[model samples]
Target: MKSFFHVIPVSHVIPANAGILMLVFLGLFCSSFGFATEPQAPRLLEVGVSDVFVPQGFDDNDNAQVVVEGIFPTTCYKLGPVKVDINEDTIKITPQAYFYHGPCLQVMVPYKQEINLGILKAGTYKLNILPDCPENRHTLSIAHSTNSGPDDYLYAPIESARVVSKERPTVRLHGVFSNSCMSLDRVVTHSESNRVVAILPIAKYENNGACLDVLTPFHKDVQIKDPLKGRTLLHVRSLNGTAVNVIEDF
Candidate 1:
């Protein structure tokens, strides 16, 4: 009796080692093709600015108190850290973070935080609200009060000053004044040649007895004799020779 030998095809007979290699290759290919899962985007939380307080006497190196309120979602936990950064005239706030839960199982919670931003100047400041989660940021303009007391005279020139007529060149002066007594005596113009070219007396509040102690708003149209020229400055002074405010390039 003759024993016949069986011949199996190489393609049909896959070795155990080759089977493991093919599985490893398939996994690598799928991962490279982005079959793996991706990370989720951060949740957004609502934040608002309740109030901002800048003390009257705060100088360039004084802290101002800011009150902020917000609501946290139920899908996360509040991480106990708040970061604040103060630039020249800007305040940035970074709120606490939230750890992800399985799902949003609870109701939204309300939270309030008070931050003391140190050493700010007495002027307009920009406050920026930044959160760790993915949400739109916010900005606010706040005016820090000056050190000038209520009794102390304070004046701020209005942004818009107009020359109604160039022929007579009647200048319109507008400003706000606060405190115990202030009078706009005259509008004096100085020329490039360093000479007093024109002196226009403010008719309404000129005399010493004409001064008033209450907060006053002044808008005066004064007539000038000579035409102003060459980088002139108009000085609006009190009767006591103290300059209340000056308008340049008139």
Candidate 2:
């Protein structure tokens, strides 16, 4: 006599995660040019930043200066960290930044020269400086490349939203939506105990929809009233509307 056991294939599970992660990285690289092979140093005069692009092999001690052709060349323009070696004579810039949505970011900072990226590595990056404030209040869409000649990289303005802590007691009504339209009103029941953590109105479109910023009080009843709460389920009166237990807690 012998005991029988079951075995699962490694190729099936591991490959899926790897593929999904690669896709996510590619999407991020496309989104806002989150990876930088070179630094972007654009000088500004009055209102706009110009001449933005890191010199080839720009190092920590490089005094790479690009002529700032603006109305007022004396205006102070804060530079994002990139191993800058700035002096009264020249301003050196390197490529490195950890950008997050915040204040202090207003206009689209343009690059000095058009970049022709050859190859890149697998990592996350941001082109500009992190706004001094927080992500939720930042509204400006900073351009990554300096080219209005139909070959520029333009990032869409993204409004900031915060994520609530899971350790803290909170109630979250998860829902599905498409193109800013509510798909179904399927509010999760038995959503008490947890503070109505955050009613995340996921904007499927590049823009539009109210950003869930106003921290509504922690109440399960009120959470249910959110427009995005029951967005997945149709009315019970409609045909094919089946009552399914979204989630059940003891």
Candidate 3:
């Protein structure tokens, strides 16, 4: 007769605490491999700011604004709100992007956004975009409030714009004036760097008798004739001390 006792292997003998730990380890491992039942959620990520465009100058009453450009590595990204932190003379702008929770196309998308920083007191300020990089930055200068003659006025707010014809290219700007006293005085077009024709629409304020408190709609067409085989940038001056940009292939 042989011994009836059976011996269990050491590997088969798992303590109660070890079993719980193994369960936790398996849970972590599954999560690491995205094997959990939970679905991925959308998120926002900081965009890589490439350049910032600041105005040549600003008056104390001027609404300061800057154009920001950045790139998105994937097509699943959409333009997000800009986070701005102003501390004394230093302004920090963090461009953001919304990431869609799904398989995104591997493509680079360039984006340009205009940030309106309402009137700033007369002073020189440093604008830092993507402070993490420490290189994407620009300076803005705001002149003290000087006597503004009747002839001087800010460009009207450009609500919407478009290039009517690429052949005899003309940019059309449609916007509204604050009141009936304001009117489109003239449109001055000048070609700047990169063959960008800047269309500046100056508004004229009439102080003769009284201006009716009414919103006035105005449409102006600016003729910008140029030959750029690849593309042409239309940097049009608008309200808020900013410029609206329109790209067209000419």
TM per prediction:
0.31, 0.16, 0.62
Cα RMSD (Å) between model 1 and the true structure?
19.1
lDDT of 2 by residue, 108-147 (tens): 4432211222222222222331222122221112223343
Q: How many backbone clashes does candidate 1 have?
A: 1
True-structure Cα RMSD, model 2 = 29.5
Q: What's the lDDT for all of these models? A: 0.49, 0.28, 0.74
**Candidate 3, RMSD to the unseen true structure:** 7.1
Best by lDDT: 3
Q: Where in model 2 is the C-alpha error above 4 Å? A: 1-4, 16-38, 46-250
Provide the lDDT at 174 for model 2: 32
Q: How many residue pairs clash per model?
A: 1, 16, 0
Q: Residues 1-250, candidate 3, lDDT per residue (tens digit)?
A: 9989989886678765897899899999998998986876768888877655565455776666777666788889999988988888888888888899868889999888888787777888888878454743467787776665311356787787898877777889988887777788888876644444667788777876887878778788877655544555677777755567776667
Better of 2 and 3 by lDDT: 3
